[model samples]
Target: MSPTLTFALAGNPNSGKTTLFNSLTGARQHVGNYPGVTVEKREGRLRAAGRDLILVDLPGMYSLTAYCADERAARSFLVEEKPSCVIDVVDAGTLERGLYLTVQLLELGAPVVLALNMMDEVRRRGLSLDTGLLARLLGLPVVATVARLGQGTDDLVRQALEYAKARRGQWKPLELSYGPDVDRALGVMAARIEADRFLTDRFPARWLALKYLEADEDVIVLARGRGPTAAFLEETAARLARHIRETQATYPEAVISDYRYGFIAALLRRGVLQRTASPDRLAVSDTVDRVLTHAVAGPLIMLAVLFCMFQLTFLTSRYPMDWLEAGFGWLGEAAGAALPEGLLKSLVVSGVIAGVGGVLGFVPLICVMFFLLSCLEDLGYTARMAYMLDRVFRAFGLHGASVMPFIISGGIPGGCAVPGVMAARTLRSPKERLATILSAPFMACGAKIPVYLLLIAAFFPEHPGMVMFGITVASWAAALCVAKLWRATVIAGHSTPFLMELPPYRLPTLRGLLIHTGERAWQYIKKAGTIVLAISVVMWAAMTFPGLPPDRLADYDAERAALAAEREALPDDGSAQADRQALGERLDDLDNRQTEEALRRSLAGRLGVALESLSRLAGFDWRVNIALIGGLAAKEVVVSTLGTAYDLGQAEPEAPQALSGRLAADPRFTPAVALALIAFTILYAPCFVTVAVMARETNWKWAAFAVVANTALGFAVAVAVFQIARIW
Candidate 1:
């Protein structure tokens, strides 16, 4: 039997590493988190050359440094797992920067096969590479690949298998000279490390010595645990560091970095790299950036882009949203006709169809927004957005990097707060990170997108595009203001400089776009069918139980009977037809009032009524209160809860109307109330999952602070809006 081999796929971000892994493993993949860390772990299995192979897709990292989360995760995996071979995916166009990580991987002593990706981009740029010479120089097999097109991937895999078969369980850490000063110090420490076998099982002695010189905190701690010998190594590192700092005006890390680059530059000089012209001047991406990233035009273009996106979202989604509404209304009517009128019928129509279906109705809008956003992201415009906003962000005490977190959280309107909060991990400053986390949830995440759209459609139906754009702007303004507040008070710190690489824009592949869009759409559908379904059922029960008190029911019944009797007393003539119609209208009004009263007596209703004293200041009736309360679980649930509440609270005459129509018809829901509701929903506390994620990312105290502070602020703003709008 052939041995099963394991290989780790590694690369810097945007190197096409993920595309390569997907091609290799296809659908055979499992994704989870690394133990005790939030970094995702992706693994898959493949069979090639009659040998079974396990491919682990490591986190995208610039280098195996122990400073950041991704770097630590990548380094830990290499040191601990010690896979059979490493397939380092290198972006061909950005070889200089890509090779930095490659050097670190080689030094780690893992047997390596280089997958030189994006060869098309290189060719397009009029650049050529001597692959064979590059492979020989690096002492590894280099397979030129266009991972996106799946070109040369099979060959890359074959070479990886060959290397894995040969290097199984054995490694010889590569050594590079860092000039005489560092080399001499490294040799002495290496000898000490070898003698004591300090972390030798997990790390090579020479590598450990290099890490110590680099002042890697993780490595130093491990070395310290080795006891007395660790002291000698530390003292040696200190002496060499002081000597180098005095003579060269630099530190050990710089010394090591300089030599590594020197090695790469020397290797590239050896008939390997050939260029026709200066790479940047001839590149199309640069030409586009000249205009799109202009000082004056950039921000304006961004705003226009935002306006267009919302316009497109609203314009394209209207027909589909209406179709969905009609479909759900039909389903509700069908359920009502089929089932006997009672709790069961109510459960099917109001609880399930009206609640979950209401959320599902917005899937088209969410999908369109997601597709557009994904296009912007894949086109590399999002990075430019961050770049253009760096100065503004810094002025507000946020790192420009916070831009991504905010965008991911729903800075674009159709995003989620969970990943948004998670993205804050990229921030180095604890103060900035906490502030970003707190402010990120204020963005119009995808969950809130439906709530915003629903309300905008209900109240500001005449100018949905502008209204949506206004809500988006409001969200951004609120986030920045709140971040400034946090910066000034609790988590105050000077802003840090932000740096990012903007990948060249390319036409997105149809397959990839469809797959991305479909996945997101399916998630929305699945959530409605599952989590939302359960919550809707529970909310339904809360609003259903403890039926109207006997005395109140009898009073409604008596009034209904008297109206029937009066209608029956009318003469059987054309003149009496008008009287009969009037009496029927009176009866419907009676039923609607009775249903409203019954709902108020239910559990959810009672809670809403209890909070009405304060909530009403914001123009929220008890029904809106219930929905807002449900929104704490998830923002989209606000839509679903509203659907359920209105369905149960209205009379049969309004049964066929959509939630929007129902709200529009209700005297309690004026345009001003709708705007105030929108304000509150936009600024309220994040969903339960996001709050929990915030706690996991930061601490429970901050999470608690976020909830209390945001809700209070949101309510205050809502009440102020309501009061001001009422006067208007």
Candidate 2:
């Protein structure tokens, strides 16, 4: 009966930190947003050595300087939560660069246990790491581990626990010399900070002084609010900065960084690391990158890889999609038959079944795409994608970092725009970040996938993959084009130079793929069941009430009775079977007209009809207009709305057809219309959630601009496509 101890897992991106976390926590983990922030937080629990342990997987960051949301969240958690221990995971192969963050963590005075991950890669490269020597030099415990293979994880955990227990929550900051002048400034600043007890309850005095030297904005803002002591520290920092700039032609931050590296280098030179291989030799990743990242062939390979991804997803997910579609269809039919014909029956069958089912039916396809994308991510190819696209991104007036936001927004087809908008925070430049935030919604995110797939199935069934590939490419083209326009116009500024670290490639484990895919798919399903279901019910009510005038109902009933009497009279004689069928057809037409008229008079239907004059230019009918309007809430709602619209408009409420089939059978829905709709969907305003996030991230002004500008652009594109295609 021991209390639970918390451990924070920290490391650079692709340092196998996530792998170690996955191995440690397995199915015991849950993901959520950090309080008041969009950055994802993952926590897992485990029972180890008769003690319950909680591991928090912090966002991957290079330092605690809070450059982006990820760094800020990680740093805030460490300072505020004060986890029992911070496990600093480092890449063994890139020990020098990895240790930079480790140095910062140590200086912050957190209890640290170094997990030297990717040890297998290090050993394979003929590099030998002297763990005991390194541990002795740093005065901390170090454990070598290959996290992917689950090697040495147990020992790493054991050491981390023992280290935490020994420290007993005590923080002993590591002091390093930053040359002569800088060290003097640090001494002065640290004394003032300790004397005033400024931010010492949260941050150590020396660490606070170091952050002030680095001009860390978060700390500086806090320091400024602490009276005259803040002014003294700022003046001291100003003096040191002036001295450094005058003598070294650089800033205090640069000097501090150089000295930290110098400290690491001095340690490594002490026989702590040995290399047996030739320095000129290229590793496997570098060798592969020569071609995969080649200027001439890289883009071609990337396109081919993306094309193949779409093809594989469509091909593999077909059967499961069919099964799901059939399952939902059967359920709808059963509900229709079991319930008496009434408002309740219509609501259940059309609103709940058709709307939510339309979205859920595409779950298999979404899952497959997510699985493939996860594989590429885990294989370290996604970074190379961003790296290769940097040139293209810069040409379009965006930072290379913008490529990731685009991808996360759905550049790969399964991304969500909320995170994509949040990801734009990583861009340092305000203009570039705003432009990226506005343009990212143009990517083909997961919510839009169902709509695209439905149209592709209904119109371009011959080449679903190629059509989807074209749609994806078109989205990217539109995003970049819009970004260029924004840069030249509204949010104009120079693009910052892009620097990114590419992790070495590795084979993705099946468990990893499944976990990633499962998390995404579950989110999609949950939204469908919750938000989609609620919207569907509201839309159904909008399309269902007021029950057509009594006169209108009577007219339809009289027509039905006349047709039935004629059919009864003619069908008594076998020779008159053809005549009886003609009457029956007439009766069916009457019923369809009655239902269509009722739909046209309903509130949502009236609104749709009102817009048809303008929407028709883009090949959209009233029904399509209704669906498009619903799409503002969520892209997936387009499909569900279409399903509900078609269901409500049907002559027989007892039978329901798959949405794609319904669209394909409708004469108004041609290939041109489908293409136009796809274009509009891609370029239109992002979902409500994304818009809210954008508003929060930037401001209501820019968020409003995104909505108006994107919708206008989408409408223009759709109109042009429809007009040109119709003429052809």
Candidate 3:
């Protein structure tokens, strides 16, 4: 292999670094967890200019200050791994702010290339930057890019590689003056660091001196452990910090930060940037946000936007859903004809086909939902959703950051609880974080969407959009309510302020949207093929064995034979043919009865029957109980399990109704029962994966509590719905 160039892509959050990374790597990338942390590590390789280039997308951060996890991870990787080059993706529209981090990167003595992303946004805002002058002043290569549109990306990469090759181990750190007091201290610290070569192998001496002055915790800890020489440096830094605090009435870290921005401002003033005369002029984004974020209008518009999206999803997915149902039905019929009446046929039709097909049948709906969600996310409406819901969340004892976790967990309908629960890491308040994690499962995640759709189509078919809307609203309401209960009782803490920068909205590119949607849909399908498929087979076996006793089989056989004899005994006239048809129908009915009896005698069936005494309070029959039990493994398995249970037990083993249709036509199921099932599925214990994640994120105690508590709450709600509906 040719020598590979390792480059780290670094930038502030929402600076389009991710867009650039995706455009460069495409499918040749994988994400892993950072060692000993939940933070992600994204690495990809590209072949460019007759060489392989390794790209590492660092966590987005505003500065190299190691305060938060992202900052720590980003800084650690840059200082230790020492990539060949650092591509600092800067938002051209926010040039001054972007350069703040750029200055810090330069101080580390790394070869740097400025990927000035969102250049189109800059031009649209009537702002111009002299890239040549900027690059000359900063002593680095600069490339203007519109990452979303794939404009200038190749050049950006090429320039980055060229700079990396040229600078190869020939780089020197840059030092910016932070006034007289700090600079004098930095000079003294630098000399001491250079003399001992103290921690200089990893960080530039000047950067180490700066980090000490800033009182960075990680750096301070390292310095403390670096023998007495580094300890002496730490003492020197402490004295300087105290002196600066006394004389300037501010900490050295604050002073240093001020100068960094000051340097950026001075650089920008040097004929490098020009803008409209009115520096504070509002752009199109401002115009849109005026209404979209309006206190009163914003929430209403948000609701309308979400409701319409769900409505659109339902409308568009209906045809494909029907086609899938018909296709699965045909496959079942073909299987019945291809195989003899035996356990193999039963396994194929009931266990594999019915189970997997049920989950796949919802693929169209999921695709539409994911595509629309990706569009909204790309257009920047998701941030607005958090912004608008912050205050409302606070009323339920959640911080504003909880909103994103909730939305990611499926507040948007197609989200997964695993990521949603994982997203709780952003919340600073431990109490609030726990509450968000526990409640996020209540959201209408994509897994639960199929279950909801199945029941809604069966019972509330005339108003699916409205029914879906209600389910979504109910999910949010339930989550918030549960959060309130948790905060008020078990986890109690004051809420933290939610502050986030809202990125300016851009028209979503078709390619970007499709790529995003495809990724999400593929994940859903993968889960079906892997987890759901395996669970379906296991549940099928559980429901299939402990076959009907010999006596019961003999009884069914005798009845079937007598019915056949009766049919054959009919006269050879037209009336006799009609009588014979009636006898055959009775025989088919008897066969179906035998199947149901056999299923009831099986292991899973017996378990469901045992639970029916308790489950009936929630209007669930033994069959629904079995499916709900399967849902404990994965919400998607609920539909699949129901398909298997119904297909195996119902009259038609060869040609069966759709799962929804089967439930609808079954006399034991009522609208009240369907509504109750929906409620329970919506509020029940999260899937096994989510519970495991919850344990990892929090603790096993809380994870156990979530299962017991959530299940109880769901059962209560389901019983209440059933009881109230029956009363009416």
Which candidate wins on lDDT? Answer: 2
Report the number of clashing residue pairs per model.
1, 0, 0
Q: How would you encode candidate 3's per-residue C-alpha lDDT over 1-728 as one tens digit per residue?
A: 65788999999889999989999998899998766667678999898899898999998888887766667778888887888999999999888888989999999888999999999888888888899999999989999999888999999988988888899845578889999989998999899889998977788888998988888888888778768777787788889888987888888889999999999999989999998547888888888999999999999999999889988998999999899888988998999889898889888999999999999999999999999999999999999999999999999999888999999999999999998998887665779889999999999899999899999889899989988999999999999999999999999878877788788998998987998899999999999999999999999999989889999999998988888887777788886877778788898889789889888889999999999999999889989999999999999999999999988897575454788888898888999999899889988999999999999888899999999999999999999999998788
Write candidate 2's Cα lDDT for 615-722 as tens digits.
999999999999999999999999999998999898785344578998999999998899899999999988999999999888899989999999999999999999
Backbone clashes in model 2, listed as residue pairs: none
Question: How many Å off is the CA of 36 in candidate 3?
Answer: 2.3
lDDT of 1 by residue, 72-170 (tens): 777888888898999999888889888998898888898989999999988888889999999988888999999888999999999988877777667
RMSD of every candidate to native, in Å, equals 1.9, 2.9, 3.0
**Order of models, best lDDT first:** 2, 3, 1
Q: State the lDDT at 221 in candidate 1.
A: 82
Candidate 1: which stretches are off by over 4 Å? 276-281
Model 1: per-residue Cα lDDT at residue 647: 87
In the predicted model 1, the residue pairs found to clash are 415-446
For candidate 1, the per-residue lDDT at 51 reads: 87
Candidate 3 accuracy as lDDT: 0.89
Q: How many backbone clashes does candidate 3 have?
A: 0
TM-score, every prediction: 0.96, 0.92, 0.92
